[model samples]
Target chain A: MKKQLQSLKRIGFTVGMTAALAASSLAQAEDKLKVGLMLPATGTFAALGTAITNGFKQYVAESGGKLGGREIEYFVVDDESDPAKATENANKLVKRDHVDVLVGTVHSGVALAMAKVAKESNTLFIVPNAGADELTGPLCSPNIFRTSFTNWQPGYAMGQVAAAKKAKNVVTLTWKYAAGLQSVDGFKEAFEKAGGKVVKEMTLPFPNVEFQAYLTEIASIKPDAVYVFFAGAGATKFVKDYVAAGLNKTIPLYAPGFLTDGTLEAMGDAGQGLLTTLHYADGIKNAKNDAFRLNYAKTYKSQPDVYAVQGYDAAQLLAAGLKAVNGDFSKRAEMVKAMEAAKIDSPRGAFTLSKAHNPVQDFYLRKSEGRDNKVLEISAKALADPARGCKM
Target chain B: MDFYSFLIQVLNSVQYGLLLFLVASGLTLVFGIMGIINLAHGAFYMVGAYMAFALSSLTGNLFTAILLGIPLSLVFGAFLEWALFSHLYKRDHLEQVLLTYGLILIFEELRSLLVDDEVHGVAIPDVFSASIALNDTLSYPVYRLVISAVCIVLAIGLYFLIQRTRLGMMIRAGSHDRDMVQSLGININLIYRTVFALGVTLAAFAGMLAAPISSVFPGMGGGVLIISFVIVVIGGIGSVWGALFAALLVGFADTFGKVLLPDFAGAIVYVLMAAVLLWRPEGIFKKG
Candidate 1:
């Protein structure tokens, strides 16, 4: 028994020494700025995550394969849209790889976890896509920067558009979660202010696609318009069911940008004439979008959507920050300040960062046009998210 | 809700329950007769949807795609039975679950490789695309009604096949005593394979039929798979009638819950399952 214990202790010591040696060797071998991506590699947000990666890579390549003349290396961990496993995945990149800047995440729940980890470690965090309002609201931090729209920004714009169209009674529907609640709250804030009555509010548990009962209820309620907040497969199913139930003819449907993005390709003709609000849209009549879209298609063999644009802008923000610090990164405060101050000539529009680090950008009022978005109106230009409940 | 709208909600519940019944029927049959927990059952459903998507694009007809897809599903199911599931028959339930789960992973990966994991909608045949006006303000979809009718006919056919046929007698007997049936000189192995293959075919058909309404996407099968298992457990395992009744009970509970109790809609299905488990640990129906 004594001999066995000694051998076990010796084995444990050798294993620990080997791990330390390997980690040290890895650090000695790489002299590049480490960028870690923790994004959903599969499930509901996989395509968005892929687009973000592609967009980021496209920006890096355009900047001569370096950000501010510093070579950047990447490590990726799949968040899988699972909030429970999110901290572990982010920590693997933050502590193990010791990445200088962590870019992530499409699901808001997972993003919340990533933001928490970034806050604890003081790691520079650039959000590529998730849009829970709390990220910029009460949970806002100096080290956390978002290149995406808040859940409120687009929803608020949709409310303004609905009010302008003379909608008196509207029904709001969404899943029950941070993103869904914030979206409805934002819409309600603007719609009620515009003298519209929210007749009824309905929500399903998050990630559940059973919308039949709700569809029947909507028909009975007979609202002037339905303001829905759903994305990915849920969005696809809702649009189809809505049309099938013949509610689309009598009542108009409005949603935030995510309801239509890549989902239009799947929804086909059912998606036509649907009005949504977002920061980015296709056919924006700008040289920046032209180049971004063309090169994105040429490289990835698919047209880039709003998610890709957010991803490209994330790299753009990082590049701007690096340029400000002359790539030294040790001046952490200055790096963040530079990032906050930088003006981005994005595919969406010319935009700058807000005090809370979320984008202050134009919201495009877009109509779905044959598997693409045609910009109809600019709902709010250089619009800053209210980011209510934020102490920062 | 008004009476007319309540009626519409009832239709919705029935339609949802019928879809569940189609998938759960196969799951219960395979579990009852073969005594194997097939987690890859959902993968077969996904395969059917993908098959319809692929063949519809090729043939330019949804009905024709489904017809061609059925044989392919049967062949694939039979191949699975021969290559992998056959060995798992006598193994422990954990081994069966693990092997089937592994199959689900492989199936998902292959689907991703082929279809790029994006949502794709199937067009409902134009003939069934019209709606029945419920009142001046509302209407019910014709395709949903047609789906329900077809499911009813299929249910009747399944009932007749099981209760009034030689094959069903052997299946029922095998469910009760596999070793005894084998000892009685019936090729019980052949019956198990047939039952397994038929179960796969039923699930695949449900997927094909549901494609137009649900919109096929990656990870689409996971939710239905979980729900189907709940149904199988709450209904007696291997009892088709039990699955049908339990599915309807779940469907009504879920539909009513969503309309009446929106916050707890997702939990209501499981709540019903738990209540049933508490009352009858073996399930709502007794084993044959």
Candidate 2:
């Protein structure tokens, strides 16, 4: 017992010393262009952030560790997918290290908070994964650019798909948050615009584990199709429960992209044939996408998702912006102009700036399937473009 | 509510309550009987989940993983009891809390190092993947029913072990007067070890079961740990049956609260705990 206490004490001392030394060393490196990547590095969203970081790092590596001929330095902080932590990390990046740009925020709620800090500091905020509509809508700012789709675009496209399939009655199940509600609202707008009735709209909270009761209610509604917007374990549990409710035979179930990959991995065979929409898919057969997929698979030993692809694009966009400015990053106006005029080729396709300063790219329809007892994308192809209902 | 909806809610409540019992039983025994306030009970739960995740992945069998995990958890609990908890048994609540509070950091950091920070999940068996039909329209996965049944059996076994057995009487007596049992020439240290091991095993078992339902990520146990403390408080400290009753009550309230009032569901549990404490300072059930 005495030996154990002594060992614990020694471990604590070593850890404390190591942390102190790392902090001091970090303080001395001042000339480099520091970019802070803030996301959930240690929580339920860790894998998502990790993949995004991998994408960011891949771009850096491919660029010979230099962006616009300047050696780049990256600082990644774990936000734990908490809004308060996002705000804290953003402040640290903006005020402490004085990072050249901030690229991150996976949760919509956290992204919204970080947007406020970006507005205050006038730093380039390149959001890659968070799908809150307000990031490019009402919350749109001169310094902010979203490389990912909003909660609206995918849901609206889903509505169009439902309309084409001639699904009359629809039931929408979403997490009761900004991102979740926006997803349902987007689908509702697109579906109703195409003359369809929304039978039920269920708003569940984030991190909800069980869905048996809600499934019972939705099954009773007997809608033609069920549109869901859940992420993480919630998505996995929902898919399992959807199958348990036997809704797949009675009513078709559809969701956005995030519901399929990590969630599907968790759900395993239960998630087979689950359809979702996105801008990028691992199964896309394009030259650029295939190359990116091959490179990502070779490097990470896992297929890259849209979030990772967007994060890579974000790094590339920053590089393009820096190049456009003739590498003169001292002037915000010059950099902003360069960023605005920049066009880049993405895994999705060639993306250019919209009036809102967000990306205008193609969307894909994907279905989850198991090939040879391992989960893989079965169907993936461009289906729609982000347009209408936004004058920004 | 419709019959199908009502039945599902009942199932949700039962499953949740059973999970709470698993954590609270360990906690209440340590606190009520031993008079030690442990904030690190949740950390053990976290350890259990991560252990199950790693072991199950390695062995490719849940039963083997559980067999290995429970002993590891017991050893961990015993180590904690010897290195930290036993020292504070004679000390006041403040010191016990401060020491156990430090244990939380130790446990969390250790778990983080051992298990990479990722939002992964434990896979359920193939047979349990399908739902059992309660009726024509209402059905749930067989895994959940299995979880409920396992919890109930464990709860019954624990009740019998603690109440009916000779060892149970000694533990009950030790809870009240540790030195008195020591004076009677009983190996009080061995008794302490047994009780501590039993407490931790319950928490780890809960973690193993819950791993499939939720994302088995870092810091996952913190949330459940706090709720279990609430269960221990609401049920009455050191009372195993009280822990069981309170676990179910809290579970039902939390599940139904979420469905009926989504916003206040989490807040309502703490509110109920405070209200119950106000009504009966010790808890809903007193230690007999």
Candidate 3:
């Protein structure tokens, strides 16, 4: 009688475990859309990653918590700001979790690594940032789509503008990194084509706080203008030091809008009258961008940066593609086709994909001025990205 | 190269070397006397810079800012020792390393929370902002020259204090034989605290001098900290004059390495360090 009771209990336990498994599968099938976000969430680039995550969240909330009628699930993994770690995380996201789509990564090198994995898996990779030109040039892949401008786009546009302004002698100070090298190179090429002479070229280290020696060198050079290629804290430091070095009155400093922002509000009047070029400034007068600016500020209680805007656009583009495929991720070719159509409304009027599947968009020239201690745009001009040999 | 241009570069190297000595000395002192490899020493330097920034902004006087910041840093050093570091005195080297590493994390996080990661840098004061023209073609910042002068004065003062004073005698003794001095009833704890505070003050003053030239931001201390550690090790860990000489060696190596082999600037220092260590494992100046 005891043996009979033990057999019955074992049967009951097995049935309960099977039932739980069936329930979980049913729940997952009904409401699953796994999306992966890989960014530098834990290292030096954490500040930018946090901003990207916030924007990603804002987009999900505004999309009614669903994409293509399926409950959206996102795995935001910290890549630790390393390219190798980014690749490792990408494997886990694709192989382990079986995420249908991937988005994110702000570093160009990290983005390139992920692009390789996405190509291997035949997964749709929506890059919201990472501006290396080679990603869309010789390194182009069919599985990747970028909503952000390429590394060369803004600098090339700025070069043309500087040439138009009839600037003669220009000095360039850029970080000693691949992205910095490409940006400065782009500027140099375009500026020379525009009939401007690059008098001096200097490369500063990343996250470098020291500028005095370089500034002293530039002072000695006494160029007609200085073009800066530094982003993040480097940008903040460059602007303050430029002004404080009292070069404001002596030499004109020109940089991309990535180097200046409402964050300059922290610098007070020190940020005033700095000239820059960019793809989009917060002061853009376009109706679509204007609305985005208002909604973003209302939601986050802070000004939306280029990273935030790119994040929002990446989500919208993914949603459009999913909608076109009728939520069928198994139809990978169809999804890729729909994404290549580039039908979403980006903040910068409209950014349609080029042959490389990278966005062919407008770049802007802007200047920073202050009112009520706020960094405000005092001037702007729009220009388009120059066509290059990039076949995807 | 022409003689004049060569002279200018040499001057640049020397000025940089002198500035490095200021920070490396403090590191050497703490490590030599206390046997605590304080990695967060660089964070104290950063704190000094921030203090100078705040005080300068508040008082609109450069001299006043330096004066206020040095004492504040000294007091902070004392507080840090009393609250946390003292407990690790009897522990092994690994514990001291972990605790100091934790301190670095806490300090960096606190700085980020307080100031945000956006860059913060102090500017050269108006009176000293002009560059001195070496010739019609070359000019150098007056501020760098001022930094070199200040470093020289401090170096002289430190030499006098260490060689001629009674406190210096006790510090030297403690570094060589802490247990023996303690048995002699020399109040070892008090001496350690004072020595640590002095070391911290020197590091902070270096930071204050550096702020006008470098960008001040979270994690800014990390680079300096590593370099100072290398300087301490290469100089025989706790040797003051060794630190000075090693610092100058490093400064020259860095400046010249960048000019000659820009791609290998990061590795040159380590390569030099390895060569030195291979020659003398206990360093140029050992405990004795």
The lDDT of each candidate is 0.89, 0.77, 0.76
Determine the TM-score of chain B of model 1. Answer: 0.97
- Looking at candidate 2 chain A, the ten consecutive residues that score lowest on lDDT are A371-380
DockQ of each: 0.72, 0.28, 0.28
- Please provide, for model 3 over B145-213, each residue's C-alpha lDDT reduced to its tens digit, 9 standing for 90 to 100: 898898888777887777789998988888778899999999988888888888889888888888766
lDDT of 3 by residue, A148-190 (tens): 8777777777777778778899998887888777777778888
lDDT of 2 by residue, A1-392 (tens): 99999999999999999999978877775546778898777756777888888888888888888787777888777877888677887898888878888988788888988899998998889998888787878778778887877887778777877887799999887777788888888888888989998987776555555565567667666788889987765677677667765667668887777687666556766688877876766566768777887889999998787778888888888888887666667877888777778877787777777666677666666777762122233232333224444454
Order of models, best lDDT first: 1, 2, 3
Clashing pairs in 3: A209-B215
Instruction: Name the lDDT value of residue A370 in candidate 1.
Output: 88
The per-residue C-alpha lDDT of model 3 at residue A306 equals: 74
For TM-score, the strongest prediction is 1
- Those runs of model 3 whose alpha carbons end farther than 4 Å from true positions after fitting are A1-26, A168-171, A195-201, A204-224, A238-251, A261-271, A371-391, B1-4, B53-68, B123-141, B271-288
The second chain of candidate 2 has a TM-score of 0.94
* Interface RMSD per candidate: 1.3, 3.0, 4.2
Determine which window of 10 residues in candidate 3 chain B has minimal summed lDDT.
Answer: B1-10
Give me the displacement of residue B129 in model 3, in angstroms.
4.6
For each candidate, how many residue pairs have backbone atoms clashing (under 3 Å)? 0, 0, 1
The positional error of residue B104 in candidate 3, measured at the CA in angstroms, is 1.5
- Model 2 compared with the native: what TM-score? 0.86
